[model samples]
Target: MKRLKAAVIGCGAIAHNCHLPGFQKNKWCDLIAVADPSTENLKKAHEKFKIEKAYTDPLEMLETERPDAVTVCSPNKYHAEQAIAALNLGCHVLCEKPLCVSMKEANAIKKAADKAGTIFMVAFSNRLYKGNIVAKKALDAGKIGEPFMIRIRFAHEGPSPGWAMSDWFYNPEKAHGGALFDMGIHAIDLAAYYFGKITHINAMVGTLAKKIAMEDNAILQFRFASGKLGYAEVGWTSKQGFAGVEINGSDGALVVDYSDSVQLVTGSTNPSGKRVIRKKVIEKNPTAGGWPIEIDHFVDAIRKNKQPEMGLQAGIDSLRVALGAYDSDKKGKTIVVG
Candidate 1:
């Protein structure tokens, strides 16, 4: 098979740190061109990877290069337009999560993907995390029997002008929402991935850390289709804390510490009737997140003419839950998810 010519649409920190390297690592793909409005970012990428083709406009790059695969790492607002354009060009796409800011945009991308008959995978990177993968396999093997509840928390110091490529993350129009959309969206998707499709959401969002219009912190309560319960928290203000997933079931539980380790947790009563807890280490730290395998998965799907697990509808389903969280915060009540 010939190497796939791949082009990246956004050359921000994410593109540099994750997407670009993921594609480059794949033996099946060649990193051909990169597009970013910031000439500095393009130059930086070129210097790092020796990529020659650069364009200020993504559509120009797409039209001119006509790569076999496209990774949309642009801001929230640009995902729909860029993804649709690439799909129209009959290219397989790997889009960053929150697919777009709204369901309308997701639908548009879906229509384009359907028309193109190409693979469209979302970057639900958490699902590919080593701990999550190990824990999920354990659950599938009945290590956690009949899992009924879950909790996932993902937080960081938040994005700043220094941390991100630009201040677009603070802009309501560009980012749509703050940590909930950026960080929380991952948790939203993970909850669904473990339990099932989320059926309802109750949420609260606030701009506690930054003086921004959008929320910098978010908390969500979820009810899955299986009638299971889940709680998720995502914040941009945390300096330090435990960030991971905990699943409880009829049997023992699985504790997945993000990027760290997976543990099997069980409890028993001592002879004195004192309760005892036990934890057995399962998998150790993973060197990287899902990014590397994610790109390979995308390229493989493209080659096989199959849709990856995190396909277009999976992206949309999770986006629906994330957007519903915002709606829940606004309506001051639980939002029923479709």
Candidate 2:
């Protein structure tokens, strides 16, 4: 019932694929405008979303349109500035993740969010999907019985020449870390969603495939506050294979396939002294990624005037692990993520 004006920054793949479309479909939102540096991207946004106003300068757009909400889908290098700008304007912001490339920028944005008093959510889309929801609920209900470990693999054939508008993802200065920061953050946040706070982290990262300045692949190991162990294998070079999430627990193991299916495995002993493995499909909702649900959740948080369940703090925590992984890779030693 509360239809509010909303604008978006960066008209790249994320903006066109999710942010713009999500705002368009939400009845409670009026898709007002968009801002991007590229004329081609702005033209596409206009032709597709039929946006009335577009700006090359996002700050000018924010000042002029003054939308009630904004989604930051810009490059990793620009997230801190754009997000801080929107938050300072007292607008709800759903920032795409790996929050920022550095802790200094992260700290600055945190202060701004603290002062803004508006809902700020990090776009950790993987955790909001149906399969993850079912797995989380079952884990909470003890269906998994004292979950102790998790493994999540999210890999793809790189962003450039495909999903990304630009090749900033391959630039170490822009992206900070390659697949580790890009795809790995999602896995890291999803791990935190199920296991809570992460205490220590170590990783192996390198540019194994594409000749990029940043790493194209990374393997991260995490230790949660609950003493749970987790590993995430993220890369931008997988043509085909496993790229889903799994959690192993005391009772059984829960697996969420790449296509949104949750399977639980429990073991039994046969009379012949052989071990038996039984698999049950507990939830299956094959769909695209959780961008729409994530946007809807952002809007709902605004309407309810409540801080999001996973807000800036969660973003910072996940970033800590991600940055720590980079450090671990550099030092060849585990890093304390306190």
Candidate 1, position 28, lDDT? 88
- Please give the lDDT score at residue 234 for candidate 2: 93
RMSD of each: 1.6, 1.7
lDDT (tens digit, per residue) of candidate 2 on 21-57 = 9999888999999999999999988988899999999
Candidate 1, residue 187: how far the Cα is off, in Å: 0.4
**Model 1 off-target regions past 4 Å?**
269-273, 286-289
TM-score of predicted model 2? 0.96
Report lDDT (Cα) of residue 224, candidate 2. Answer: 89
CA shift at 10, candidate 2, in angstroms?
0.1
lDDT of each residue in 1-338, candidate 1, tens digit only: 68999999989888887888888888888899999999988888888877868999999999999999999999899999999999999998999988998999989998999999989999988888888888888988999788999999899988885578766898889998899999988998888888888999999998896777888899999998889999998999898888999999998889988756789999977799898788988988732557768888888888888898888988999889989998899999999996
10 residues in a row with least lDDT, candidate 1: 285-294
